[model samples]
Target: MSSTFDVMVVGLGAAGSSALYHLSKTGKKVCGIDQFVPPHAQGSSHGQSRIIRQAYHEDPLYVPFIKRAYELWEEIEKESGKQLFLKTGGLMLGNSNAGVIKGAELSARTHDIPYTYLSNQEISTRFPAFKPDNDVVGVLEENAGILFPEDCIKTHLEVAALNGAEILKNVKVTTIHTHSDVVTVGTNQGKYLANKVIIATGPWISEFIPELNLPLTVERQVLYWFKTNEPSIRLDNLPIYIWEYAPGKMFYGFPDLGDGIKVAHHHAGEPTSPDTLNRNISPEEISSMKNVISTYFNLNVEFNYGTVCMYTNTPDERFIIDYHPQHKNMIIASPCSGHGFKFASVTGKLLSQLALDEKPELDISLFSISRFSK
Candidate 1:
């Protein structure tokens, strides 16, 4: 039997949902599947909040793409009538010369983003919860804030379904192969074919595209939500903050959004495969975090909840977004280096264009898969 769709999306998270939504708008037949429905804790999109900032601290090349992502996220909100983003201004706090702080300042200056500089004293006066050391400085970027991650993924997938896309959840894609001009995907229930394929699987990217193993390692990360005794220091009054306690050490947290004040370390994680990653937090890890967080927020932090997420990282911490070198009809997109959530909306647009053989408005040289060739 012959089976086909205009596009077959292998993962239903942010990237796949966005691509399905955009493809559906064109009245094309797009089919999407996921091992588990997203907004579920099974994948990378379950966290309650993700930071969205205009300042491109990672690299100046990211500024434009992020700007477009912000715009598209707003557009999606307007179209869907859903509250997908919350504006909690962001602060980059650390030594002025630190890569996190300096890179943000440089990006803001390069892109002309609205920002403010603050000394340790100024930060304390404005936000009593934060008590940076005397030498620490802060870069306040007005455009930075948080995105309601779960809502964004759910809304996009719902919109995609409303526009003619078919989504199958709780189904596993076991195998995929290409022949002649079509690609065949075998799932738990059945098989389907498509002219084009998009593999946006987060940590599982390597499992499906082993040829480009490209040194993608999955790291086990933990998210902690703490309840604050002072309501004034909670979500509404406090701004999102990213702090570097010392060289090469970073932690970021969001204000209490009813649940509690959510905080997590940026990169201190044990390398593990997604399937075998341990979900439980260790006492040692909690003790270490308590020490760091107590330095900033008042010690009255209440340990409320915790969850585990996976970070698919590359050597340089950049993303891998491009077509399979050997397969013209297959596209690969796994930007899960812990900072990819914010760019998911815009990335979906670009991935859709690439699958359709159309040019994206922005340059993608910086994110090309070829960067790993060396």
Candidate 2:
């Protein structure tokens, strides 16, 4: 294998694949390395589905970036000849004053994104699968839906490879050294040199840049699919929904698509590490999730199966997509909390721009690493 390239992207998951694809389009000598084959179940992008919504509950600043992300997803779908996004609409359900509901409404209003406010009774009438409390309201947006994360990552890598980008899989990167004008990345397989490097290694990001002391925590999250025989719980009737059952706690779910209805908590997972994570789903965890489903939704609560994934989170739970503080040629772009998969399409483009010294189209100051120093 060649030992040099224009740019090297580490971590071939959501962001890394996308970055490689966009970088390849620049006609530069780009290469991507991954410890394991992508589109696999070991990382954050393997779940069958991930929600993509325009109403930014985390912050309204994300609205513009996600708007562009929607466009890019469509472009990739058209180019790759694969269905990437499913627009089933989405609902944010909680107390009217709750952060989830209020924050979603604020983003919609600030960005002029079309949305409908529904009362508890209205929600039950429109979507019979849901049974929110009298005080819980919903912010319904037509543009919200689900994205097949594994397919998206695979398609990105495929398209990049076809465009002449070399993708090295099952190759663990051992160390990275940045000189005055070049960066050297050492992998178990061999050493490769590049003009720049992008670190989007998800939970394993801190391992490569330990000096940053980034406030990143990897949380063990469990995703469950419950068997449902009800017709109302099917895709045609139930829109993807995020419910805030309590302050700072959330449960998001997708309608049945033959396999079953997929559900998981937004956060509130046990702290863990990538090297030593418990992949098993315990009965107590299953019962805990069933309790939430039975109380809020009108569907069968029988847990069919469960799987575990990791969420690399920062203190603010936003994202980290800035250059290394000391090494300008090295970019850090991982630990997206849990809400980043939806933005991977556009995030990749932004990272490519940063890697190539082009201006990013969106204001990403909120994701800067300097915030942690303050």
Candidate 3:
């Protein structure tokens, strides 16, 4: 009916699994619970591949987190003996003065990261598969690549188990109440008690902490995989790319990894709730994407298939990695605003540190909840 743990992770998707793994390393009694078995398509961490790049176009503040994330990824890959990341390089493309280009360049320069500024002709010459306009430019970072998200989550949970963390799958947490000394996590199965709790529940977080009234929205994003057999568009010649087609509008693509060429718009998605998100991909949606992406890629390919995901977006699209304002023993982590999978590994370790009352080695002051205080 009830069990106690040092730490209880309520959502074992991206950051929660990693937190469990890291916490398990400390030999503490840690447990992770997920409503659905993770690596499943029901949530944001389920896509086949996710992009990981050092030159963060969103902001340079993310560079240090990414730098540590890469190291943690390799560390886990070796521990799990599974190839989680693939090196295919990355390209941030947009007009010469667009946010995609300027932000990427600024991060690269600020962090002293290795990057190459490519003009329109240079981009076309280097990556011939792409169709860049005369004014389109790019910032190429060799360290950019792909991460097997499902495999990463699986590996994290497996390794965490091997390290002695209890993984409770198919267990839906209904409520969390802070007692005098422990947090009571009421679940469909029963109840769980923990000295500290980490709620990385992605889109479902707002349901748990309504008092915060945190400005968060759940967006329904669709990913497309178009069937393309162009020999020029092979993985060896192509790099993971995010293009700002028109000023603020942007879409991203990956090389055909057998399934097809993966493409999706960054922030253009319908606002919806996790429980009520429409998973069906309509003909109009596919046609709309096809019409726009056709000008950039050889969209002579047919729409093989598409899948849906959710993005728990903050007002500024940054991440929240701090303690709950009311409950000091509870840490809240909502890292998805379209881009979060890549940082799962490091975020896990940070959560472990916070739960254990240890100062995080890396500065997480940027993600504090106080910023939203008015």
Per residue, candidate 2 scores C-alpha lDDT tens digits across 18-120 of: 9999998999999999999998888787769999999888899999889999999999999999999998999999998888899999999999999999989
Position 228, candidate 1: lDDT: 66
lDDT tens digits by residue: candidate 1, 1-374: 23689788999887888877777777888888899977688777777899988877788788998999999899889989998888888989898888778888889999999999999899888778887888889998877888888889888889989998889899899987877699999888889899989999998888888876577889989998877678656766678888987887889988878887889999899998877989998877777777777877754776777899998898888887788888978988887788998998888888888888889778877777888886
Model 2 ranges off by over 4 Å: 1-3
- TM-score, cand. 1: 0.97
lDDT of 3 by residue, 1-374 (tens): 55679999999899999999999999999999999998689989876899999999999999999999999999999988999999898999998899989999999999999999998889888887788888898999999999999999999999999998889999999999987689999999898899999999999999999999999999999999888778656788889999998888999989888988889999889899988999999999999988766788644778889999999999888889999987888999998898888999999989899999999979998888888984
How many clashing residue pairs, candidate 3? 0
Cα lDDT of candidate 3 equals 0.91
The residue pairs that clash in candidate 1, if any, are none
Task: Please identify which of the two predictions, 1 or 3, would achieve the higher TM-score against the true structure.
Answer: 3
Model 1's C-alpha root-mean-square deviation from the true structure amounts to 1.2
- Show the colliding residue pairs in model 3: none
What are the lDDT scores of the predictions, listed in order?
0.85, 0.92, 0.91
